[model samples]
Target: MESEPTAELIRAQLRRLRLAANLTQEDFGKQVHFSGSQISAIELGQRPFDRLFLKRADEVLNSDGLLLGLLRIAELHRQPHFLRPWLDAERVAQQLRCYHPTLVPGLLQTEHYARAVIRSDDLLADDEVERRVAVRMDRQAILTRPDNPPILIAVIEEATLRRVDESFRGIMTQQISHLLDCVQRGGVLILVIPAEVSVHVGHAGPFTLACGADGDWVGHLENHLGGATIDRAEELATLHARWDGIRSVALPKGQSELLMKEVMESWSTI
Candidate 1:
């Protein structure tokens, strides 16, 4: 079997020390040089700790274990290599506030819909597409585990509800069906932003807010042509306020579910 992801092993140790010391992330951040969001990211395995950060954390958390060993592993083995930090954050995020302006989030996609989206990409080979899809499916495990599944609150634009082509439409319909199932299980919140919302907050692109178990929220955006994770409080607070407004303007869940049904019906007609 493959060795455990290096980031995960380090997180396990840091978490043990933090809990032992009874330090909240904010408390810990003050002792270290990181922000609370960055500390949370470290604990979540989304971001690797550089030597300076690790040394500070080791001193602050009063860890006696092998910090260097852990750091070496993280330094050498990280892949998706730029996104480990974001992925780490998602695992421990207890709540998710997300928006998709043009497409469904990967975690919410059906296999067929995911494939169609991949097939349309500019330069991906079939093997690469399959590998990426597999990775996405694996990533969904965090929000699906039995212990503490993350609450997903998503606001999707009305445009995403449209069926662009029949082949993709059937897949999307199934995806809507899956969403309805998730709603039934009480793990998801789906909202549709009206076509005529005069002002919208997520015109930029898809993004999310991830709340760590320590009750800190990390703002998320994958940058243009790449993804970046943001943990600054100033930015997170602004994003939180924007999310509240988006939630307010979006259709109510009941109506949204009904509308989804209607869209699926329309898809059959096309």
Candidate 2:
């Protein structure tokens, strides 16, 4: 197991390098296409370091790839405890397949829905909650950005689509609308499994499978008890079969979008 990376160390290094280069935070921000405040937030450990920022810092500070190297190590250690390995796999995956029996997948969750989901973990402090929400939102970047984004296919249960919170009706509406927009964009696919499906492998729980460009595959299985990432070929094969079982019964993209529209419209009346 690799030791967790320390943000404080990176912060110290950034401060030293920037000063050595005689660049003020504002000057550095200008060079990196970030606002001074954003740069300050990163140096203060209030915001996470992104690859782009580190790349710019490396160039501006003449440190070769030191900042980027730090970021790579930092990325591995900063994930929420249980999600560490899955995140590592996600960073390099060429394809992502997610099947959720209830609730939205984190990658597709709207900001409000993410907050609601994170708040469910009562043990987290307010700042920690906000930090997690930011992390989840940031993870969505994988679906876009690069010229070739990963192929993202999600199969959500009918119950999840129909589920609503009266207090957050507006937010739910926004979420559904966002989902609709996502499917419209290339590289994303959304399917819905109806409530009537009597038997399916997904009935066991939600799981995500990530396939790397190099042909490696991993499965992250999650339920109420806990979660684990399975890399064993035999275990991944089982999960792959289960995904096929659930996906086979799921509604096509057209129908799923129609159902999603209905759900979005329902929120308008509330």
Candidate 3:
């Protein structure tokens, strides 16, 4: 098997190719339609380069698609090793069932909300936060993809909708509004487990089960340290039972939307 490309490897190749072509960063940037500083940041590994930038750079550097190829392999390995399996399953899932007691499901989170959530850790540097946020936003594509997007049934606790981050004013409102928008757009169903039913199985933690096209299900469980991909039959069965318990208490689609709107309005007042 071919080795996955590393960030350092890509950066080194870019610098070497530019030097070999006898072109300064400024000159190369001109050809690639990027600013010299932007190119500098990419070469220095200070900025994350997307596919478009890599393709343009490859063309300008005459790398014969080398850079683009590296980017494709690098992206597949960019996510944390622990998450790669679950991410792979998520992309091809036919349906997803998720339950969250503390925050919105990652698949439905807006960029701003995602950034705030990742930043809450306080241990990660700014760049790491941005990177994780980008990965999360990318994962959301499965819901909107034109080619058979997965149907998402997300059960979120009512408290999650009302939780406020005083530091980030109006973040909750924007997030809740985004959730409402997602439901309106189709392929997503947001169900709220009202606070009145304070005790429930979902209160144990958050988990997601991805149902593949063939009807096989894989489960993912998360915690502060990291997460685990669960495929064992007994574990999957437990997850399915928990999901049913959570869904049983959650408000139906219509009531959930109304509840979200009420919380959003309350947030607007704060």
| Model 1 spans with C-alpha error above 4 angstroms | 1-78
Off by over 4 Å in 2: 1-5, 13-76, 80-82
Each model's Cα RMSD? 14.2, 5.5, 4.7
TM-score of every model versus the real structure: 0.69, 0.76, 0.81
Question: Residue 55 error for model 3, in Å?
Answer: 9.5
Q: Residue 125 in model 2: shift from native, Å?
A: 1.4
Query: Residue-wise lDDT of candidate 2 within 121-202, one digit each (tens)?
Result: 9898986687677667767888986756789999998788777777878878888888998998878899988778867778
Candidate order (lDDT) = 3, 2, 1
Writing each residue's lDDT as its tens digit, candidate 3 over 1-270 gives: 112347778888999999999999999999988889988988887777766677788888789999866755566686679888998899999999998889889999989989988898988998678767766776787898999999999999998887776765588788898999999999999999998998998889999999999999999999987899999999999999999999999999999999999988877886
Candidate 1 vs candidate 3, TM-score winner: 3
Clashes of 3: 0
Q: Rank the candidates by TM-score, best first.
A: 3, 2, 1
Query: Which clashing pairs does model 1 show?
Result: 45-88, 46-84, 46-85, 46-88, 47-85, 222-227
Model 3 worst lDDT run, 10 consecutive residues: 1-10
Candidate 2 at residue 238, lDDT? 95
> Model-by-model lDDT, in order?
0.76, 0.83, 0.86
lDDT of candidate 1 over 3-103, digit per residue (tens) = 25765776788888888899988888888867889889877867756556666777877775356457544433434566677777887889888887788
